[model samples]
Target: MRKNFAVIGLGRFGGSICRTLSDEGFEVLAIDKNEERVNAYAMIASHAAVGDTTDEAVLKSLGIRNFDHVIVAIGDDIQSSILTTLILKELGVNHITVKAQNDYHEKVLVKIGADKVVHPERDMGRRIANNMASSSVLDYLELSDEHSIVEIVANSKISGHTIIDLDIRKKYGLNIVAIKRGMDIIVSPKANEDIRANDVLIVIGTDEDIDRFERKVMQ
Candidate 1:
């Protein structure tokens, strides 16, 4: 079954989520205290409303509990964010995801039963820093504080070498989960598979090990 979603606060973060979910064919209800923001999403969302979500009556009236998941993306207003999440929990909303401003805000949201908390700004900063640190790195995803999955372009130095010849797993302590070559994606490439120049390697490892591999091989 398709899940119904309600996104409270129509700032850049919440607006992006609403649009993406709607584009993916999910039913999304967009809400904001500002009438202008609500009107802007009226044609984009399944429903759009200008109402204070912190008010229990407003939430109940909107039938918020019936939605499968709720996203609280209130920007800068930590108190309103926390209050809305608390009300959603009290109303027995099945899943609640919130955008947190800082560590303290995240802790409070989690304590109040938020199913997920996202730090978009902080995460994006880390991703950008990783990309800038290595020219070969095409993209980066942080699995944890110490572990990451990065897409790295194979340079001439590592080209024409087979997985077995490179002994990447043993030498770098990293796993090449997949290889993106042109339009083809080789998942769990065989040991004899040769890596060509410009092939994107999807590698996962600890940050320390990945940095070592990038310096020694990619450089």
Candidate 2:
């Protein structure tokens, strides 16, 4: 099934999102104030409109609330971003996601009923830094402030052992949610499931526990 997504602000982040969503068979209405930006996405999105998203009248006219998810990806302009987010919330748009420029902006967006807030620049920076700093670690996804689900290669010691033998849940408070072996993915792997060497473990746990597991079992 496809979703109707309204993407506001056609900067790098918003543009990338709009194009990808369209490419993935989503109905995307991409909005941007700049003529050049709107023109850039005109052929890509299902609909491209040049409008000041901060204006409630324009937002209402566009029927933005009808979309399943409205992403306020306004770039650089902090005031416009907050105002647009507020308008989206006031208009009763479900699942509003706003891009936060900084901590202060995030606080404001949260207070205004943004269902989700994203710090793209900071997050991308952290991921790049993490990748640069670690060799064993491949990727990281933040589940919350304290918990994370990471994709890491299994170490030799823990490889070829069943999930029950590893005792990951009890010993480390981590869950081997799945095993990605070559092209196969065993979702919610059985307790007695055997893991092979070179298999990727999609594990979920607290940051500290994940780190410990990584150092001990998944070096």
Candidate 3:
């Protein structure tokens, strides 16, 4: 069965999640204190309501805890965000994801039993910086503060060499998880598989080791 989702706050981040989840065929309840914001998403989300999420009575009336997953994306209002998250936890919501405005906000959310905390702006900035810093890096996904997965295009320096010949795991402490060539993708490529120029390598490793590999092999 598809999971039911509830998104509190119809701001940019929350609206995007609501729309995407609806497009993917998930039932989503979009809520916001502003009637206009809720009205705007009425057609896009499975259900839309205007209510003060920080108020326990309002949240209970809306049946907020019934959803399988709840995303608290209140923008700028740190108090409302924290209060709403705390109420959701007390109500026994299965999963609660909150957007943190800063490090301190994240700490408080974690302390209040938020299942997940995200800093969209901070993460996006890092992703953009990582892509700009490397000419061959096409994409970057941060798994944590210390590790990441990057898609890098093979160049002359690393092309035509087999995985075993390059000894990527031993030398750089990175793994070539997959290779994307044109329309096809090779998953868990063999050690003897030859890498060709223009192939997109899906590499995973610690951030420090990934940087070393990129500088030593790609450049």
For each of the candidates, give the backbone clash count. 0, 0, 0
Candidate 2 runs further than 4 Å off: 124-219
lDDT per residue, candidate 3, 59-106, as tens digits? 999898799889898999999999999999999999998889999999
Could you give candidate 1's per-residue lDDT for residues 43-126 as a string of tens digits? Answer: 999999999999999999999999998989899999999999999999999989888999999999999999988887864434
Model 3: lDDT of residue 131: 48
Candidate 3: residue pairs that collide: none
* Per-residue lDDT of candidate 2, residues 137-191 (tens digit): 6887777767888887777888878999989899999988888999999999999
> What would the TM-scores of all predictions be?
0.60, 0.60, 0.60
For candidate 1, the per-residue lDDT at 149 reads: 96
If both were scored by lDDT, which would come out higher, candidate 1 or candidate 2? Answer: 1
Give the Cα lDDT of each candidate: 0.87, 0.81, 0.87
**Measured by TM-score, how close is model 1 to the native structure?**
0.60
Minimal lDDT window, size 10, model 1: 124-133
